[model samples]
Target: MTRTPAEPHSVPAELGPYLREVVHRARAVCGTHLVSVAAVGSVALGDYRHGRSDTDVTVVVDQPLPGRTLSDLAAVLTHPGLPCPATGLELVVYDAGFAARPSGEAGYLLDLNTGPLLPGKVSFDPAESPAFWYVIDRSVAHRCGLPLYGRPPRDVIAEPGRADLLTALRASVREHGLAEGHLGDNRVLNGCRSVLFCRTGHWQAKRRAARAVAASEERFRPLIAAALRSYERPRSAATELPATDVRTFLAWVAERVGEAAGR
Candidate 1:
């Protein structure tokens, strides 16, 4: 059975119009196959930064979408056609079966990445991308996703087991730490959020998680504070975080998550 969309007033004022446009375009393309549209990531977590955060969205369809429909949906929802208000739009579409019972692998019908921060690409094959990110995103969606077009997230999306989440978190930490070049504030704040989730089994806004971690972890206070400051500022105006400190913080967080998983 189809469900009504959530109230537009429930989201940030700036995003209300953009989201409405997205739903309109998606409905036009997918028609009856569309099952739900939900807001995830920073928006759903209630700490969305106007210029820095990407608008992360999840769409569920009744079954696998044909190639033509996927192309049509991507054309309308992506940049230029829809114009994302945030840094970009990271939208993923999953079949209802996969949304209800996601396996250990990446299983999505469409993965559309658009805007300035991310490379513009439309991927249909799961093999084209990494699996860990999808797993973690699903965990977050199941926990706190806000329905925009259909049934509540928890009703259509299943939560990954704690162990599986921890595994994905560990992989994420490693990937962030090992990557070369600018580590950025996201690494630090994501580390804080990952550790918080490992310990409490709940998702939190990056800023809130950084503050909470700073209050308790005195050793990482300076690092987290710097990260928070950078995160709050506009992406171009933000100061650079110390790469060494960010990597060190991620290592500590990984250890903490590993310990929690062992318990």
Candidate 2:
């Protein structure tokens, strides 16, 4: 079930004063014309696990900052309430006017123009960054966003050397071969996109499978065990090869979209 947003949309005791300090730093770095800043990831989702979570927030300015705004805010960032050496989950800044402008369709999953960071723009950047995939592979619904109104964001338009990415996702599938682990990873990635892009109901079945992957390390453990079994047959605890099953597993993932598309 979806949880209610914190009572005040603005910062409150819930985030503690320390995090607010980060917001202030973000505001100064972003300047006064910015639109909104709010917690986004595990912390915002209320799914954060102490020590396991990093702060995720978005700072929307009146216009886009030069680049890597994090570098500027980094100096002023600190907090006893959250943790030290905070990392990942950026404090992105963008101008409201630009955010509202429409970015032509492309490969990116979230609409940059209207992304959580900008709030009203549309972008088509390929969204191919490794760190971007990392978050999608880990959390889906938690991060997938929908505008309260207006059309949903589109995926980055870059066709990322489709043959290359597919070859890689497939090679990894064939070699290491863990149905559940990779499936879960794919699920999270696709699920986040599906939800962010407003395709949830249409892709619900796949999302369900992705959720299972999130919980099944043992099923996936077999892949690593298979590698071990190769060298230490006698000592190997693995029962059989996942080669055949991995193919089928991948097929299931691929049926949806992107690299996993078994086709």
Candidate 3:
């Protein structure tokens, strides 16, 4: 049932034309059930890096579609109907009720993520693990999410409270371990962003957060600088900071977040 992405719709110029076509194809397949389509993460933040960022998309449906219909929609998105501009897409289809409900679990009916690390392949999670990242994403979307179609992000996503967000951030760091390999840059930057958010209730992109903290926290300058190089540089030139340093940085971040959370 996989078909090519076609047609085009108006969206942010940064999303480019290929993605716009994919959006149109997705809507065509979903028909009346599709409620809203939004761009989250870096693309929505106006800081998307052509090769380094993933196109994070959230699709809301009025109700659960039939199994066949869901499969078709997935095919439309994953079939490489258009040349993807970034690494690839991390798409989630959510039921309208769950989307509108005041919960931060995501409650998605379908989840798919693919990228250069997983070229021409996708990971499907019908029952994704509980993570604070989802909560953070919703919060970002509520504040500055880009709507491609349908209702506004605020109406579609419930506002996650600061207390809950902090709790989730702490748990995420404790359990996920410090990410390694290509994810090392994001792991460090995200850790910094989480700590800053806990202290300031402000959301920031990874590079911005790294710079913000590194400016005032001289102790973390080396670690943050290395992360910035890896994050901003091409993958071939990305540097790996020593494992011990990464662990130390993460430990420091965890402690700061815990103290801020009063845990």
Worst 10 residues of 1 by lDDT: 175-184
Runs in model 2 with CA error above 4 Å?
Answer: 1-15, 66-71, 78-89, 102-251, 258-263
Q: Encode model 3's per-residue lDDT on 167-190: one tens digit a residue.
A: 778876765354623467777888
In model 1, which runs have C-alpha deviations exceeding 4 angstroms? 180-183
**TM-scores, one per candidate:** 0.95, 0.43, 0.87
TM-score of 2: 0.43
User: How do the residues 3-56 of candidate 1 rate in per-residue lDDT, one tens digit apiece?
Assistant: 677787778888889988898889989998888899999989998889888889
Model 3 has an lDDT value of 0.72
Q: Across residues 170-213, which tens digit of lDDT does each residue of candidate 2 receive?
A: 43333323454333333233333232223232223333334444
> How many pairs in model 2 have backbone atoms within 3 A of each other, for residues 3 or more apart or on separate chains, i.e. clashes?
25
lDDT of 2 at 100: 43
Clashes (N, CA, C under 3 Å) per candidate: 0, 25, 0
Error of 2 at 109 (Å): 18
Error of 1 at 125 (Å): 1.0
